[model samples]
Target: MIVAEVVRSGFVESVHHGIVALTVGKSFGDVDSPFFPRSSNKPLQTVGLLNAGLVPREEADLALMSGSHDGEPFHIERVRAMLAAAGLGPEALRCPADLPLGEAARNAWLRGGGEAEPILMNCSGKHAGMLATCVVNGWPLESYLEVGHPLQKALADAVSRLAGEPIAAFGVDGCGAPIFAISPMGLARAFQRLVEAEPGTPERRVADAMRAHPALVAGTGTEDTVLMTAIPGLLVKKGADGVAAAALPGLGAVALKISDGATRARVPVLLEALRRLGAETPEIPEVVLGGGRPVGEVRAVW
Candidate 1:
């Protein structure tokens, strides 16, 4: 379906085609197409870590472990603490070094003459959690990201179980960790399991921690943070290449992907899907900008 239209000078210039998957009722577009969920699968990976005996000191810590943090000061401090708890440091992380994802933090880092550091990477917390799991299980830390590694295999199993589907393919993520491909329906199923998991279970624990510390899941203006804040008990996560998923416990779940990989098209389609599911969502602008001025708005066509 043409979920979003881009206009310029009162004329439609482009359209975005996408799919929306739901846990119940009818779905739109190609929900069965296999695609990489990217970082959106972090929660399931954290579940694997938990199953491997990784015990974080706080629920917020678990949230951070499942987060693609913005590399703010608080986020960095938490990652450092996680590493410290496992008797490791930034040097132990396998993810490549990168600048902060938050605009303000990036500007500050540049102003202070900061350079790329593994701790500043968005996936640092996940890496820290993986290291902690390795420490707890006495597994080899150096090859933790390798596909044949015990940790990666465990993660694969957890993802398959939660998604209710076997991985169709695997690839390396931007952070060097393994990524798995599943249908949009499978992705929605995983999130449904996450939000609807019984209380006191590891799945529910991760969801609760994320809902409790939404800021840790993403940055201030990020979609996940904004959506979760606006709708209590809602779980939202976005991945690279225009993929996103959300689940309202005991209500409904949605997963989507834009064909052109435009991140801007993601939220509008998601909001529309949620609305169809009878969810109350905050008003979000779908404006397109030109020269820092609003020139158009994206609207869902179906």
Candidate 2:
């Protein structure tokens, strides 16, 4: 297990546990064990959207579909337009709505006395995409969140194929949507295919969209977007409760799940994973305090 300690106000306040490391053309510990992917399943779900012809073939909104956005006004507006395009409304969204994560955006909304709209929810784009799929495939808008739904079944099959494993479990997401599980290695393999997928394929389209529109993929500033923007050809995705993955085409993939559930350490763990893969970037600076002092370091446990 990997231990990530959090230091605040000059003291250790919390710790997050997880298994994080790089595997080179091979699976790491318990990579075969199935685990629910939560939001990490976004890219796989997009395949259904593509296959059903609900979304444009040349477009890839994979990043937004998988993103936990900051709820910027622009993000909210786009989500709204997406829903409108699908002939749906905010009431149709199963995900909870909230303000953007960015202080500027949140405060601005407050200053304007803007109430939280479903579109402002970070998962709004994902929900909108799902609704669009339902419209395109003539699926019922009601109970679309059900596991047995055709759209969901297709998504599950796509996930299984990408992970090279069968779905092992199911759960409800915070957004009131179905969630599927796969092993750590399975998760890694899914990401591996995402980056290495054949060009023009659904998987590759998602990758390309994410690569092309890093900002729209998340928001003005978010880890997933920042990492992709900072590095070339590095496909990154973040999930709830400290789950994250990074895949480099031909190099391999890395998946992390924090045991203690502290998500604050996600960025550090991801940076460590990148380091293990022998990839370098300037964003991963050592943890430091106000005095320019090294507070605590993020070291790989593998």
Q: Give the number of the best model, judged by lDDT.
A: 1
Residues 59-152 of candidate 2: C-alpha lDDT, one tens digit per residue? 6455677576777766777777777777877888877767766677889988998877767777777788888888888999887889999878
Any runs in candidate 1 off by more than 4 Å, and if so which?
A: none
**Among all candidates shown, the one with the greatest TM-score:** 1
- lDDT score for residue 51 of model 1: 80
The TM-score, computed over Cα atoms with residue i paired to residue i, of candidate 1 is 0.97
lDDT of 1 by residue, 23-115 (tens): 887788989978998888999889888888889978899888888899899999999999998999889999998999989999999999999
For each candidate in turn, the TM-score is 0.97, 0.89
At residue 300, candidate 1 shows an lDDT of 76
